[model samples]
Target chain A: MMEFINFYLIPGLVLGSIYALGAIGITLTFSILRFANFAHGETMLLGVYITYSLVQFSGVHPLIALPFGALLTVIVVLGIDRAFYKPFRNSPTIMVVIASFGMMLMVRSMVQFIWGVQLKGMTQGIQRPMIFFDSLRISPKHITIIGAAIVLMLAVHYLLSRTKIGKAMRAMSDSPELAKLTGIDTEKVVRMTWIVGGALATAAGVFLAIDTHIDTNMGFKMLLPMFAAAILGGIGRPFGAVAGGLVIGIVEEISSYPWIGVEPLLNPGYKAGVAFAIMIGMLLWRPSGLFKGKVF
Target chain B: MSNSELQTVLELDQIIGGYGDTQILHGVSMRVDPGEIVVIIGPNGAGKSTAMKAVFGLLNLSGGKVRLNGEDITNMPPDQVVHHGVCYVPQTSNIFPSLTVEENLEMGAFVRTDDFRPRLQELYDIFPPLAEKRRQAAGTLSGGQRQMVAMAKAMMLEPQILLLDEPTAGLSPKYRGEIFAIVKTVNATGTPILMVEQNAKQALKIANRGYVLVDGKNKFEGSGHDLLEDAEVAEMFLGGGAPP
Candidate 1:
């Protein structure tokens, strides 16, 4: 049982937490802005690179530099919104989506130009998991990932439920024209959406880099799982994304788990296919996801 | 309620504007003085709604101007127009469907820095149905209830002049009378109104003055009684043949 917990459940929980963070951003951007942001993966990768650069220059631990990188990512995301997305606010949603695809390529190339194609790491030494019981162990990095995710999620919930800007955001997301008629500055709402989404993306990136490794392709690889999580949670529901991400993460991780008693059920290489299957299955059963979230 | 000292709260001086590349209003002009109700009545497709949109700054005037208390507000973005003490309630989608009735009310006060609790209480007292459904989503409300929410939301700003584009567009006779009563009560509180309506008879009954717009130009302008009483105006607009 300890071995099972350590091997499958714990790792799945950590991976799930990262995807939860990313899916929250995707769900938020999708809910308010009404488009599938194809560049979301690239945004996360950009945050990781930003973290790597910040740690080198500021001489701080990766965790300490995480927020600084996230803050910088906010600036980058806001700039992207203003330059690429805002102009298409009145245009068809598909237009903005195509623009985001362009943004994906542009941001990917910029990351390559700055950080190069080499795989980057914040620490050189291998960190060992501290053993608890017989064959049961947990890593400090995983603890940090789990802890940070809970903190951010709570903060997000508070913001959405308690604050004035939060209510304004909900109002805008509900009916943009009515929000305008009520004199809520819509441009400001758009900016706030990006800020929230960008911050969450940064958190996901930092945690993922801490857990595994960082590269330009890490975000791209995580994209399928993150999107599956968002869709599974219901595309517009932030909390739903959380549940969706965890389920998808566990399912994906377990799909690759080597059988302890019998032959392997599936190849480990087919891990991504697990996310796809869940997404497709959910789409068929409940297109609105577990939350019945708004598609428009 | 118009005192001799009443100043025009809002005015459209021969405003000419429309949505992108399509001209709707052709030199439309009107005004709402302090504490008075001015109603615009016309046939469908006569630019009655367009005139309201032009005055509300939703349309960019290619020619002419819109003035609020003598401050030129031509072509201002609709969001900023509220700052000029003017609030507009569109004909459709006036309420945020997903927002609670109370949240909709709070949104109405988005521009105000002062506390809005007193104003909210006053509105709730006037529209008791809203107070009952304060926490309910506006989308789930009945048509009449939703209209009340919309009007109440717009009134939260305490606007000096309201541009209402058909407050009674779709409602039962009972709800229609209820809405008109509320409109009259709101206007009696020193907030003047400029409303466009399809129910000409009921609207002109309470209107201090009325304008008949035909093809986006002022065809007839008079007191509500005069417009309602005019044989020629009645024949042309009220679906009657020329008087003998």
Candidate 2:
């Protein structure tokens, strides 16, 4: 029993951390842009591709590739905002959502055409496990994923609370028109939000690639679970996303076990189904999410 | 007012403007000299706010020009108007709700590259209640406090002129007095002020000059006391529920 607990629970915790990080980016983008970005998954995939290239050609350590991946994603997101999002600044919300879909399809096709549809593992090669207790081990990949999530979350907290631009972003999120009259440069703050959100999603994608295999459609596959975490946590609540991710991750992993089911034929592959189930439950009970404040 | 001593801070000359396709201000002309308090009062839909918005570059002026000190800024955007030393405090939804009072003030000085700590201190000193609640979120404050923050934030740039659109709208009678008192204090400190208010009777009491607007035209213009005491002006625009 203890062996099972250590193996599944600990692994779920690590996976949850990555989902939380990705959801934070999604929620942040949603708040600032006032629309759901269906294209965020592609942005994450772009990060993974960048990290993969670094590891393939330069022989950079997978851990070192994390920050590089974040930086690259920031550039990509900012460029996309300048080219795509800024043009529709005053357009309707439905128009922007459609534009985001267009962006998603464009990025997805680009990734498939460039990288091809194949699962690629880390080139640097992951090491064996580092033991934590008797019959319990913690891998370096898990440590990196968990550690980076903590550090990045803390960094984001500090930036929002301490920095001037960060405060401006929060103010804009609360009330955009008011932010403008108060002399907050709405344009600059919007740019910074996209940059920061893209960076975090990129970091999460790289971490995810290290833990599993990298593929062009990996972000697309993670979308349902990522959104489930965001909505379940509360649409624009950051800390709620973190907490929701862990809950979803643990529930998905635990329910996938055949022993828990009435019908023993059910496989662990049903984990995806579990995310939808949890999401439906959340929607039925609380439409505004678990922590109700502001969704848009 | 002396010709040389009358330092014009903001000049809107025969300006014609509206939202789109509809003209609200038909040849509206107004001015504010340095250290003077000018008030524009009228019934609802008299184009008073529209005229102020044209000066702030918020509306598309179809004709005439807006100038600061002597330079033409007829077609400039609202954001650029701030750089030209024109600060406008809108009637509603003016301060960021979720931000702290201090943070909102910081954003008010967004265009400033130099340190604004001294300016912030000065503002806090000017608004002592805000000083005690500097860290509190602006949304959490009372309606009066929010108005105070909005006014103080606009004042952060220390612009040569301040434009206010119905600063005392929807406030309690007590808050109306408080807002007027603050406006007087703000104007006494060298910045010229041009305000539109629904509270005409009270507004003219503090105003140096008053303009009575009716149906997008300047119906009456004179010293505040003269307009206040004019029975014809009072019967026409003040409170009879009919246009004379």
Candidate 3:
């Protein structure tokens, strides 16, 4: 049990926190914009690279450098939205979806060109885990990631529930035509969606980087699981996305947990398959998902 | 009455519009004077709702003018139209399904920078059922209650004029009568109402004046009482029966 907690459960939760953050952006964009934003993973990658450069230059902790990275990422995302996605706002959703796919390639190439496809570490040396109760182990960085994720999640909850603009955002998501009739500025709501999505994507990328090394493909690799998380939680529900993320994360880790014997139950090599299976199963059975989100 | 008091609050002049080259409203014109309930009663495809959309700028107008307080607001988008003190409750999908009733009202006052709590309270007082279910999702309400939520949402802005497109379209007889009473109560508060109603008799009973539209043109325009008593209107529109 101690080995499972230390080796599988703790790592799964750390990964889940990162996925939950990234999935929030995916779910928001899918809901409000009414499009599958294929370029979202690239946005996360861009934030990670920016954070990497900031840490290298200022010698600050990744957490300290995260806000700057997120801000810069937001600027870049807003620019991309204006240049590529804005023209397709009134066009068919497919047009914007294809545009996002093109953007994914363009952004990935740009990151490779600037960062040279090299693996970079956000922190210099690895610190050992802090043992609690002589058997369980928890890393200080993991604690920080989980704590920060909780704070951000609470902030998002407050924004969506309490603030005027947040309420307008929810209103727009619920019914865009009624929202327009009610005098809510659609463009302003769209802009706010991007800002929130971009910031959360940056936080997700930074958290992942703190856990593992950053590479050009890191965001792309995590993209599938994050999408699975979003779909599992429900297309537009932020809280559902968090729950889906945690479930996917824990399941992926536990799938290889040697539950039957000591031979590694599913041979950790195929862990990514778990998310895909769950996602496909959800799409087949419950397209509205656990939170009863929008079907489309 | 003084000249300013008699001024029209909302005027639709020679409005011609429709979706994608199929013209619906052909030179439709209507007006709502201050402190009046104006109903436009017409058969299907007579462009009654289209005229309302024209006033709200929900469609493209090839020719016409919408004036609010004598200011030309022709072809203004729906969001901008709300700022000009004209609120419209659509026939269907008027309330955000997922938003709570109070949140729907909040979005109604999205343009206002000042406090709207008093107006909200006033609306709650007018629509008592909505006040009890203020926190419930608007979609979960019955058809009649949803219509109440829709009207209350439009009233949140306290507009100079209110346009309701078939407010009681799908309600039962009991709820429909209740809605008519609610309309009269709302009108008593001095907000001029321009409504398109299928229940022509009940609507005209509450309306100060009414218009009879046929094929997108005004067939008749008179005081509600006069129109109700008109022999031809009674034969064609009032179900071929004597005036009740």
Candidate 4:
């Protein structure tokens, strides 16, 4: 039990926090923009690389360098949106979706060109876990990641519930035509979507980097699970995305736990299949997801 | 009264427009004077709603002008038109279904920079039922209640004029009567209303003046009582009977 708690559960939660953060952006973009943004994973990768460079240059913690990375990422995303997405605003949703897929490849290539395809570590060395009650081991970085994620989630909640622009964002997601009739500026709302989505993606990338080494393919690798999290939570439901992310992350880790004897129940090698299975099951049984989000 | 006070608040002059080369409004013209309830009643595809859309700049006009307070606002987008003190509640999908009723109203005042709490309270007073369901999602409400939410949302901006497209489209007669009464109460508050209504008789009963549009042209324009009394209008459009 101690080993399961320490090695599987704790790691699952840290990974879940990162997935939750990334899934927020995916869900927001999917719901508000009316397209599944394929470039979202690359957006996360771009932020990670930017934060990696900042940490290398300034010798600051990734968290400390995160805001700068987020700001830069937002700028780049806004530029990309204007160039690629804006023209397809009135076109069929598939057009923007294909554009994003193309953008994914383009951004990945750009990252490879600039940063090179090599793994880079955000921190120098892994620190030992702080043992509690002689058996419970919780790493300091895990605490920081979970704590920061909670703070950010709370902030997102406040923004969506309390602020004017945030309410407008919800309004747009609910009904774009009504939002326009109500005098909500569509472009402004889109810009705010990118800002919030970009910042959260940056935070997600930074958190993941702190947990594991940063690689060019890191974001792409996590993309499927994050998407599974978003769909499981509900397409446009942010809080649902958080729950979905935690569930997916925990399930992926626990699927390999030696629940039956000690042979590793499902073999850790097949962990990614768990997300795929959940996603397929969800699409088949509850396409609207757990929160009754928009279908399709 | 001063000349400016008598000036038309909203006017559509020879407005000609439609969707994708289909000209729905062929030289449609109308106006709403201050504090008046102007009803535009016509059969299906008669350009009643299209005229309203043209006024709100939801569609482009090939010829003619939309004037708010005598300022030409032709082809202005819907968002910009709201800033010009015109709020339009579309016929369907008018409320943010997933948002709470209060949030819907808050989004209604999205363009307003000043404090809108007092205005919100004022709207709540007018629409008492909405106040009760302020926290409930608008979509979960009954058809009548959702219509109320839609109208109340448009009222949040305290606009110079309110444009309602079929406010009582799918409500029961009881709710329809309630909505008509609510329209009168809103007009009593001095905001001119220009609405397109399917319930022509009831609408004209509440309207100060009304227009009878046929095939995108104004067939008859008179005081609501006069139009109701007109034998030709009664036979063709008002279900043919003695004036009730």
Candidate 5:
């Protein structure tokens, strides 16, 4: 049982960390911009591709490429804002959601066109699993992904609590017009939000690529889980996203095991089905998710 | 308040504005002169707040012009209006609730490139309680203190004319007096104030000029004392009282 737990549950947790990171970005963007960005998954994919290209061409270490990838994602998302989102900002929320869906399609096709439909394995050679006790084990790749996530989450917490920009973001989330009246440059705050959100999502994408092979479809697959985690945690609660991700990870993994002899009777293809079942159950039980983040 | 010394500071001439198809302010005209206090008092739906919104460019002015010191400012965005030496404090959530008192003030001077220490100290001297609670979150402050922060923030630009939308709403009588007293001090510094207030008597008492609005139009306009003494205004507007 312990060995099985080490092999699956631990890896699920590592994957959950990535999902949490992505979900935090999603929730932040949703709160500030007031829309679910379906295109966010592409931001993560772009991060992996950019880092992969950097490692291939620039001879930069994958570890060093993390920040570079995040920065690139920030620039791209900011560019998207300049090109698209900011223009239709005053339009209805549904319109913005449609636009983001359009953005998602555009970004996905662009990635496919450029990178081709191929899986590219990471060449950084940080994949050796480190044994922890008898049954628990961790790898350098997992350590990097988990460590980076902790650092970024802490940094985000401090930034939101201690910095002027963070306060402005929260204020805007609470009441945008009031924030403007108080002299917060709403544009600057929005830009800062995009930067932080894009950076985190990009980092998660690169970390996931480190754990698994890189492909354009990778982010697409994780998109549902990330969204589920974010919604389960609450729409705008940052800390809730992290916790929601872990809970989702554990639930998905534990449920995929043999359910009273059913797993022995059925093939392992039921794992993804079980994950979605848990997600649906969560949605039915709590519509606002656990934290019930901001309404406006 | 004679017209000779009262140089025109703000003017909204035949202004029409609203949110989308619903017209809120219908040809509302008003003015404020430098170093003067102009109060607009009326019933709940009298468009007093809408008039303030028109001046601050919060609403689309469907018709007419808004001018500040002779420059046409009709339909200018709020940020630009702030740059034109006019600051507007909204009625509710006027201050950034999540920010510290000092940070809220800092945002007030966001457009300023110069060092704002003198202005900060000036506001500190103006509101001593705020000075003590500089590090406190604006949300954590009492309603009156939040109103103070909002007013102090607008004053950071040292605006030539300030527009306040119901500064005394939802405050205790004691806090209302404190807010009105602060308004007097703010005006004493030579910034003309045009306020739409629910407390008609109290507002008119402090006003050099008063406009009693009824059904989106000015019903009466005169010196504060004149309005206070008018039988119609006394009964209908003030609900019968000497000026507070």
Candidate 6:
């Protein structure tokens, strides 16, 4: 039981936090901009590589390079929005979707062109784990991932509930025409959405790279889990994505353990399958998602 | 004839426009003054709502200009209309359905930089039902309550002139009466209004003046009682009933 708690539960929580960070971006983009934003995973990949380069240039720790990387990612994604997505905003929905898929490929190839295809570890050494209560061990990297996710989520919550721009974003999401009638500056709100979504995606990438490995394929690999979590929780719900991410992460980890009589039927390799299963279950039971979010 | 040109709060002078090249409102002109309720009644496709939209700058106008007070505000975007002390309450999608009643009110004052508390208090006092359910989502409210919320939100801006498109649309008779009573009380606060209403007979009762529009043209313009009593106006539009 002790081994199970330490190995599966703690690790699951870390993985869940990473997934939550990514899904928040997805949900916000879907809500404010009204698109699936398939390039979100690639955006995270760009963030991780930027953090890697920042760490190398400044010789700073991954944790220290995080904010800079996130800020740069925000700038990059905002530029991307202005260049590519803004022009086609009023176009057909499927056109924007196809554009995003193309953008996903575009971003992936850019990372490959610059950083090459080799996998890279964020930190130099095999860092020691921090010991908690009896037989409970966790790494500093995992602790950072969990802490960062919590802090970012709290900041986002405060922004959404207590700020004017946040209120405008929600209002626009509810009804764009009504929002315009109410005198909300829709363009400013759109730019703010990109900033928030970009920063969250960056944090997700940086933490993910630190915990596992940094590579061009990192974001692509996370695509299924992040999207599944977003869909399962609620397409346009930020907090719901957090809940969905934790569920997917824990399920994926626990399914790999020998819980049912000795040997486990599901392997850790079936982590992707766990996300698919949960997403399908949510779709079957409540298509609006757990929080009654936007169905599309 | 009701309010002179200088006293008029809003004037739509020979307004002509529609979606794309199809003109819905042709040479439709109307005006409302300070502290007056001017109601527009017409058939389903008679451009009553289009006139309101053109005045509120929801779409482009092919001809004619809208004057607020005395300033020409022709074809200004909807966002800028509220700044000129004019606000619009859409017939539908009036309130942010998912937002709480309080949030809807807050959004109503979105463009204002000054304090909104004074007007908010006044609105709550006027609509005590809204005040009691301030935390409830506007979507969850009954049809009458939702109309009240919509009216209350537009009132939050404290506009000198309020433009309403079918405020009592699709409401029960009891709710309709309640909305008219509220509208009467709202007009008492020095705000003039131009509204399109479906219940022609009931709406004209409280209206200071009324316009009968047919095919986007003004068929009859008279004092509320005169139009209510005019045989031709009644036979053609008001369903041949006594003004109740």
True contacts kept of each: 0.75, 0.50, 0.88, 0.94, 0.38, 0.62
Q: Which tens-of-lDDT digit does each residue in B154-215 have in candidate 3?
A: 88889999999999998999999999999998999989999999999999999999999999
- Preferred candidate (lDDT higher): 1 or 2: 1
Candidate 3: residue pairs that collide: none
Cα RMSD (Å) per model?
3.0, 2.9, 1.6, 1.7, 3.4, 1.7
lDDT of 4 by residue, B1-244 (tens): 1235248899888988899989888898888999999999978889999999898888989999889998889999888899999999888898898899999999988988999999999999998889999999999999888888888888888889999899989889999999999889989999999999999899999999999899989999988888888989888888997486
Candidate that beats the other on TM-score, 1 or 6, i.e. the better one = 6
Residue-level lDDT tens digits of model 2 in A1-296? 65456666777888788788888887777777787888988899988888788888788887787688778878988999999999998898888889999999999899889888888997446679887667677787788789888998898888888898888887777777666655668899998888877888888788888888888888887788888888888876777788888888877766644466454333677888877887888888886678763644
- Candidate 5, residues A23-44, lDDT tens digits: the string is 9888888888889889889888
Per-residue alpha-carbon lDDT of candidate 6 for residues A130-231, written as tens digits (9 for 90 to 100): 887857788888877898789999999998877888878888888888888888888899999988888888888888788888888888888889988898
Score residue B233 of candidate 1 by CA lDDT.
80
* Second chain TM-score for model 2: 0.95
Per-model clash counts, in order, read 0, 0, 0, 0, 0, 0
Quality of model 3 by C-alpha lDDT? 0.91
Give the alpha carbon lDDT tens digit for every residue of A122-233 in model 4. 8988799999999999999999999999999999999999999999999999888878878899899999999999999989988998988899888788889999999999
DockQ of structure 1: 0.65
lDDT of 3 at A76: 97
Residue clash pairs of candidate 6: none
Which of the CAPRI classes, incorrect, acceptable, medium or high, describes model 6?
medium
Question: What is candidate 3's lDDT per residue for A1-296, written digit by digit as tens?
Answer: 99999999989998888889999999999999999998899999999999889988999989999999999999999999899899999899999999999999999999999999878888879889999999989999999999999999999999999999888888888888888888999889999999999999999999998999888998788889999999999998999999999999999999999899678899898999999999999999998889998888
Show pairs that collide, candidate 4.
Answer: none
Give the TM-score (vs. native) of candidate 2: 0.92
| Runs in model 1 lying further than 4 Å from the true structure | A1-4, A123-137, A257-261, A281-285, B1-6, B232-244
Question: What's the C-alpha lDDT at position B199 in model 3?
Answer: 95
